[model samples]
Target: MTIAMGEKIFHHQLVYNDYAKLSRNFFNLGSLLEKIFKTTFLSKSGTQEGENTYMGNTGNKEIDVQGIFSSLPNVPTALFQSQCVVWKDEILICGGRPHNHHCYSYHTTKRKYKKICEYPHTIRIFGHVVVKCESDNNELTLLSFGGVDVSKYTLLMSYQSVWEKSRRKEKKKNEWRVVHHDTSFGTRKSNLTGASALIGGKNKDLLFVTYFPNKIDVIDMKTYHYVCGTGSNRLPIKSPYSLQNHCFVPLTSSNQTVVNHFLLIHKNLSLLIKYNEEDKKFCYESLPTCPSLATCDCYGFISFNDQIFFFGGYDASAMTEIDYIFIYAMKDRAWTQSKHSLPIPTRGCCPVLIGDGRFLHLVGGLAHHRTQAMHLATTVRAFDQVCFFFFFLSVIHLVII
Candidate 1:
C-alpha cells in the first residue's frame, strides 16, 4: 500500500500489457509461438497434463473477444443458488452458500428454467457441487462430487468432495451415482475440502482429482491411484486448486488428456500441476516434496492454455490484473492477453466452462462488490470467431461531381 510499492506494481502491470499486445499481434504471434515451443522452462520443468491447449490451429480462428455476451438483458429470475450446468439439454442449477431447496433447470429454446431435480433434504448444503456433463464411450455422465454440508458428518468423512457419478448418457434413463462418501460434505472423505475431476476418457473414462488437505487422486469405475497433488501428508489451509471457494468448465477433451492433470487456484497463487501417468512411481506419484504453505489457496483459475486466466480477487494492487484475460502459452512458457475483457468483475460464482474445445460457454456465478450484498448472474456467454469480407464503395456519379 506504499507509494514505492504502488509504483512497482504499476510497472509490473504495464509490462504484462506490453507482453499481451506482443503475443496478440498477428505478425509477431507466429514468432512468439516458436519462442513458446522452445521455452527453456518447459525443457526443464514440463507441464503436459490436464488442461492443455490445442496449438495446432483448426483452420477456424479463435473466438472473437468482443463486446457480445455482456450486453444481453440478464432478466431477473427467481432467487437461485450455486451454479448451473447443461443437463439433458437443460440447464440444471443448484443452490449454494445460504441454503435453498430449489434444484432447477432452464430451457434455452423456451427461455424458462423449470424444476427438474431437487435435494432430498433441506439445509440446502453448499456443495458448490455440480459440473458440466461428460461423456463415457456412449454413456454421457455428470461427475458429481464435493459440496459443503455439516449435517451429513455422521454418514461419511466430514471434509471431502463426495464422490459420485451420474449418467447423462441417456436422457430418458438419467441415473444418479451412489453417494460413495456417506456424508455429502465432510473431512473423513474430503479432508476439509471438496473435489471435482476432468472426465477425459473415451467415455467418462478418467478423473484427475485434487483433494482438500493434500493429494490428487485418479479414479475410474474400477481403480484408484494418486495422480498429482500432495503425496501422503495433509496440505496446509486452502488445499490445492481449492480455497474458501471453487468451478469453471474444465477444458474437457477426447484427445490425449488425463484424469490427473489439474491446476489448483487459491487466494494468492495459482498452482499449475501436472501428472505423468506413464511414470508411475512412489517418488514420482507424489508432488516434488513441497512446503505446507506451498499449497495454500491463491484464488483464480488458470486458463486452458496455461495463461493463468484470472478474474477479480481480494487485492487492490492485483486489481490491475482485473478485466484482462491472459493466455499463458504453455508451449512457449509465456503470457498473453486476449483482445477481449471479462464480462464483469467475477469475484464469486464459478467460471466453469462448457463446450467441445471450439465454443466456450461461461455461465452463472456470484459477483458482488465491497458495498453490494450479492447477486447471481445466469447470463450464458458463448465465445467463437467468424471471418467476413465486405466493401463499402457504393457511390453514384453525383457524389463525384
Candidate 2:
C-alpha cells in the first residue's frame, strides 16, 4: 500500500493482504460487528479456513430422554422433512417423501410410537407442510397441503385434506378421519419445502403457502378463501426457489395488527414480509443480509418468548449436518450467536415448545442417522433475566477472545 503527500510518497504493507492476518482480522471484526449488529456476520458451521471457530464453551445443555437409549422407542423408518405436530398428549409425525400416507403417533406418557388408523390417499407427500388448526367449536384438525411425488415428479392435489380426530361412536378415540377435502383450491407448483405456515391474526387465522420461483397462496383460514398470485418481476429482490428448502415462519407479536407479518429464511435470503389488509399487498422490510443463515437451508426454526431461534442445519461446503445456533431477539431487532447448540448436528427436525415455553421437544429428523427424539431445557436462568448488563459483558468476552 502506498500513500502520497504532494511529492513525498510512502509505501507500506496492508495487513489484510496477508492470509493469516486476514483470518484474525475477520474474527475481530466479526465479534465487534456482532455486538453492534446483533447478528452473526460469519457462519460457524463449516470448517473451512477463515470461518469462525468456537472460542468459548463448545458445550450445550444436556438433552433429556424418557424412552429407549438414544431414540424414541419404535420410531418408524428414518425419514427427512417429516412434519411433526403437537396434538394433546401426543406428537403426530406424518407423511414424507417416497410417498406414504401412514401417520404415526408418539405417546408422551407411554414413551412409544404407534401408527394411527387414517392413511392419506395423496401421493405427493414430500416436502409438504402439515399444520394443526383449531376451530371455534374446539375442533382440532391437521391439514396437509402441496408437495411433489418425487418418483413421478408430479404435483399432488393442492386442495388440502383436514385430518380430524373421530368422535363417532364406533371410531377409536385416537383415529383420524379426513372430514373435509376441499377440491376448489390447488397450487401447481410442487417440490416446495418450508414454504408454508398457518399465521394467526386478530380477526381470523390465515395460511400462507409459497410456490417455486415466485408465487404465494394466501388463504383465509376462516372462510377457506385464498388469493393466489406471483410477485411483480420488477421488484427489487427475487424470491428464492421454493424447492430449495427455505424456512418460513410467522412472527407472532401482540404489536402486530389484524394483518399478519412473517419472516422468510433461505440459504441466500432473509426477508420480512407483511400483509396489508387494506390493499391486500405484501411489503418487504429493508434488512441487512443474514450472515450464516444466508448460506444454508433446512435449518430448524422456532419462536419462544417472542424471540426466534435458528439452529442445526446442513453445511453446504461440508455436505454434513451442523450444530450452529443463532437467536434473533424481536424486541431489540437483533441477532445473537449462542454458545449453546444442539446435542447432535441435525436438520429437517421440528422444534416443539412445551411446559409453557421452557422445554423444547426436538422431534425426529435426519441427524447422523435420524436422531432419536430428545428434550432440551435451559439449565441457566431465563434469557430476559440476564439480558441487562450481563449481555454486554458476554459480548465483550467474545471480542476479547
TM-scores for the candidates = 0.51, 0.64
Model 2 alpha-carbon drift over 4 Å, by segment: 1-74, 97-100, 135-138, 149-186, 189-194, 228-243, 254-258, 369-401
Give the candidate number with the greatest lDDT. 2
lDDT against the true structure, per candidate, is 0.35, 0.53
What value does the lDDT take at residue 148 in candidate 1? 40
**Tens-place lDDT digits, model 1, residues 156-268:** 11111111235332333333334454323333435423344455444555554554545444545333333344344333334333444432223323333334444444444
Instruction: Please give, for residues 1-401, the per-residue lDDT of candidate 2 as tens digits.
Output: 54342333545465336645544454355344333322222122232433222211113433332111122243465455667776555667775543545677766655556676434463455666777776234334666665442321211221111233363323333443333444333444344544455565556576776545555557777666664453441223464433355666677565343257776666656677777766667777754445776657777777766567776888776788877777776666777777556666777766665555543555555665544334332311223322322344465688899
By summed lDDT, the worst window of 10 consecutive residues in model 2 runs over 152-161
Best by TM-score: 2
Backbone clashes in candidate 2 total 2
Deviating ranges (above 4 Å) for candidate 1: 1-66, 71-81, 87-89, 122-124, 131-140, 147-195, 200-206, 220-259, 267-309, 316-324, 352-359, 369-401
How big is the RMSD of model 1?
Answer: 15.0
